[model samples]
Target: MTAETAVPAATSFAALHHRPGEPLLLPNAWDHASAAVLAARGFSAIGTTSLAVAAAVGLPDGEAATREHTLRLALTLGSEPYLLSVDAEDGFSDDPGEVAELAHQLWAVGAVGINLEDGLGPAALHAAKIAAVKAAVPGLFVNARTDTYWLGDGDGDGDAKDTLRRLDAYRQAGADGVFVPGLTDPGRIAHVVRCVDAPLNVLYSPAGPAVPQLADLGVRRVSLGSLLYRRALGAALDAVADIAAGRVPGGTTPSYDEVRALERSVSARASANSTG
Candidate 1:
């Protein structure tokens, strides 16, 4: 579909957060093909992983280096069937207006949501960026992320206190949701849920609580941030090693036709939607 046809998807993606007991399981994609395959598999919403985007382009993540690449990917996947949310690491700038402009461009390209991280910076600055993005494009779901826990070098009590403080600032600044990535403890998760009025987004940890557990703890969004990308890389390496060792690689590898079918289905659906 054209970007115009994808405009209403923002509302649908916003509604996904309000479904109780079923947090939006947001699987992040790195590029057009990954997003299309996930959309074909029936994921209503897909997020872009900044790490994957950076790694794919041989750039380092979290350094505000992949702005152009991020925009390019957004332009490519903007019209897909699934709702698109971009993991814009720190919005690629410290200036609130610049970050808001980035949000504007993403929205214009048909992105429904944007994730902005504080990177443990000053909470006030991060809040200003959120406020700017909201003012620029209020329809975009701003998942305001605070890395206090993720980057904290303090005790649990101190980290929780700081995280709550940052989240409060973000909420006051008009964030649609708040995310604390490194938080894994059930008690801490429940505490944050109780304290925050907006939707609480938690990163899914393989060694931590599962989706069901996170749902039980009152998380509105469960994001698989970069895990799929990392796993894909790992699988590719393992397959190559197995081939060199003369052992059959064991994994659910999709056939070439299946992948091509995903591409064809996307094109067909876009054509049909555009015509309708």
Candidate 2:
């Protein structure tokens, strides 16, 4: 609960992970409208979707091509009421210092956490990035992500040793949490949860375990990743098809005034310190 605690943001965000079973269900938002709506709906923390960030600019995802877009979006959402965690894919560079600088900039803009993915690259390099970020911004929660399952080139269940090794390294290097995006097996998940020293974050998969099941398996954070963006795209397609077939859209649509209110709610109360 954000503004719910009225405490230091990092403390509020870090506390969300220690609740034994009730994992923090972080929904990813793409733009101002999406983030605003999610915040209005009472999500204490919001994360940016890297996929949507790149796609919105007609660029590719996971190629380190969206750093500016990502930072610009973070600058836009950082001053909001809720805690913000960014999905900085691979930290947008190979050098540790660069990643750390990015973390510092994000922290300066009011981000409480950052997600750094390994992309199945060298585990040692990812660990270095994690360490550097923690050294630069001690208060910023670092959620170290490893893509062993996504790029393992084998069955998801068989990448246990590699996953454990990478995640453990990240933990030792000061990662506040570890994320495995493509992992969904209950036994494997519970296994990683048992092995990793830090909080375990698993990407929410529609065909895999639901929130309750994930909670039961001891997951501490569940990320939506790009699911919301993908679903929104699907909704747009469905709505257009319905209109063509002489049928109205089925999903809930916010009124124009209500949408406008989301913006005015923020702009109406400018900070007293703004010189302009």
TM-score of each candidate? 0.94, 0.95
**C-alpha positional error of residue 50 in candidate 2 after TM-score superposition, expressed in Å:** 0.2
Backbone clashes counted, model 1: 0
Q: Report model 1's TM-score to 2 decimal places.
A: 0.94
Q: Which stretches of candidate 1 lie over 4 Å from their true place?
A: 1-7, 262-276
Q: Give the per-residue lDDT of model 1 (tens digit) for 1-276.
A: 345555567778888998889999999999877887788789999999999999998999999999999999998888766789999999999999999999999999889999999998989999999999999998899999999878886356889899989999999999999999988999999999999999999999998899999999999999999999999999999999999999999897989998888778768877987898
The weakest ten consecutive residues by lDDT in model 2 span 1-10
lDDT of 2 by residue, 1-276 (tens): 233332388888999999998999999999989999998899989999999999999999999999999999988888888999999999999999999999988888778899999998999999999999999989889999999887776364457888998899999999999999889989999999988888899999998999999999999999999999999999999999999999989998999999999777767646433544
Model 1 residue 20 lDDT?
Answer: 85
Best by lDDT: 1
Enumerate residue pairs that collide in model 1. Answer: none
Q: lDDT of each structure?
A: 0.91, 0.90
Against the true structure, what is every candidate's RMSD? 2.1, 2.6
